[model samples]
Target: MTKLTCFKAYDIRGRLGDELNADIVYRIGRAFGQFLKPTTIVVGGDVRLTSKELKSAVTNGLLDSGVNVIDLGEVGTEEIYFATSFLKADGGIEVTASHNPMDYNGLKLVREGSRPISADTGLADIQRLAEENNFPAVTQRGVYKQQSVLGEYVEHLLSYINLDNLKPMKLVINSGNGAAGHVIDAIEAQFKARRVPVEFIKVHNNPDGTFPHGIPNPLLHENRQDTIDAVLANKADMGIAFDGDFDRCFLFDETAQFIEGYYIVGLLGQAFLQKHKGAKIIYDPRLIWNTIKLVEENGGEAVMSKSGHSFIKEKMRAIDAIYGGEMSAHHYFRDFNYCDSGMIPWLLVMELVCTTGKTLGQLVNDSIDTYPSPGEINSKLADAKTAIARVRAAYEKDAVSVDETDGISIEYPTWRFNLRSSNTEPVVRLNLETRGDKKLMTEKTEEILALLRQ
Candidate 1:
């Protein structure tokens, strides 16, 4: 039996030839079909060059296993999530490597109701079955069909905001030549039909699998310059950018300054709390102060979950949370079957902008000032564990409280920080926040970085 290195903690991600391929992907589809035994499944792919071939292979495997497949041709990851529940499909899969390098490709899977299938929730078992490569012969093959849920998906997104409330605004949307362009186009059409006054300035809007603008990952500062420049040139109200699969969308304000995802969490939390009072909100442990304060002040319960989509989704489902967000730019909604969407967050945030009669910067600047942070800082060290231990030992002695939910979080009255090591690499991530004290945040961040590096 061969071990599949593509099976990651949450999804399948790996190099194309050596780790992931059409053959291995077919095995995964068969294995998934066998594991869940779902009668019907939905499948889709991103704008990667290999995505179509891999999607076809996986669909064939699923069909051979007696699972009918509804193929959503050339869509973003969230489209699969939406179609799974909308079509009442028993399962769904998206062949996407997201922001990974060009030579890599991956898959994201979900069970009924679009619940994620991660390591703890049938991923490991699927991996085992695929590795075993032992399957009973199929007597009856399942049907295969192609469909587009673009209309329904766009309407669902628009449901979050009122069309009449939208003011005249010009926004820059940079798809980075990924799968998000089509969805943006559909939304723009809806806006025009409804006579909404939002004008979209598209940048890198075409879905070129070659990723002419460097891989569609706006998280990298180097890749964000185009979106920022477009925002500045147009003097747009806001700027939005997405990765290859469009599962995560980054934002910029009128000044073309990138707004940290940490503050977006607070902004979105407040937006939901406005309508869904007394609702529960879930957030990750990496960054907390701003979100917790916003939720609590707005008469909502704030729950902390371990970082990662699976963990956050599970916690959101268990707690019946109205909304959940991560500093990494992933947002989950209860209305959307508790699934994370890169599309929903911006819509909700834009709604907030119009209703409050505030600029995007005005909406988030207060939180940034009150809870100063450097966002998430990553450092590569050979001995990540030892470095984490070193920082914890140094801080725990003087800390008021220590939390080990995902990693180790040390808290003081005015400042708190969480340190977690990468599950697959020699990288340590640090997220620190100060209670209205930028100087203290900077000083402490430097001090902790020094200790971890040492």
Candidate 2:
């Protein structure tokens, strides 16, 4: 039996040659088919150089396993989530690395209804089956067919906002040479047809497996300059940049200031609450006060879940949350089967900006001012657990309240912070915020970092 290092806690991801290849991917597909016993499944890939080949391998394995395959060629991860529920497929897998390095590739899986299939939800079984490489003979081979879900997917995205209310706005969309270009083009065509006065200034909008611009991850400060520069040069109303698979999107204001994902989460929650009063909004535990305050002020309930895609989606499903968001820029909508979409967020925000007569900066200024946070900061340590414990011990005693919802969220009267180890690395992530005092927030953030480092 061969142990697969590619199988991760959340999904499958690995370096190109040694960890993941066609053979391993094929076994994974067969194992998934066997585990789920699905009659049909949807499969797609990102713009990575190896994604197409790997996607084919997985699709072939599914077919050989007597599971019909619906191939949606070259799509963002959210599209797979959308298609799985949209087409009523039994399951879906997207071949993507999703902000990983050039040599790494991975898979994102979802069961029926586009619900996540992570470690707790049968991924372990699939991994075991793949490792064993033992399978019963197939009585019948499943059929394979290629189709385009772009039109329907585009229409579904349009459903998230009012077309008529989208006023004249100049926008900078940086696809980072990934899979987002096609969808943006499709949406642009729609805008043209509807006579919507939205103009797009495309930057690295073409899909290039080479990733000449960078890895398409907006989280990295160095990777964001092109988008920011484009927005400024074009004087666009807003700027949007997507990750490799486009699952998460980062935003920029008209003034070319990058908006933190934390504020985006709060803004999105407030928008959803405005639309459906008393709606439930799910947020991650890393940062909460801003989102919670917004939710309360808008006649909504805010719920906190562990900080991850699977956890957020699971909690959203459990509580029937109208919308959910993570400070990492992943936005979820109930209308989209509780799946996160990078595309949907920007559109909704655009509508919110135009209709509310506010600039992109204005929409988030108050939230940032009210509950100021420096966003998530990471500190690599020799012992991440010890570092986390040290920070908790230093503050928990004086904390007015402490909640270990995700890691350890400690709150005082005027300030709060969450310190936890990374899911995949030996690093402690610290998120600190203050009550309208950037100085105090900065002070506490530095204080926590010092403790974590010590």
* The candidate that achieves the highest lDDT relative to the unseen native structure: 1
Error of 1 at 271 (Å): 0.7
Q: What is candidate 1's lDDT per residue for 294-334, written digit by digit as tens? A: 99999999999988888888898888999999999989999
Off by more than 4 A, model 1: none
Residue 324, candidate 1: Cα error in Å is 0.3
Candidate 1 lDDT (Cα, 0 to 1): 0.92
List the pairs of residues colliding in candidate 1: none
Worst 10 residues of 2 by lDDT: 419-428
What's model 2's TM-score? 0.98
TM-score of each: 0.98, 0.98
lDDT of 2: 0.91
Position 136, candidate 1: lDDT? 82
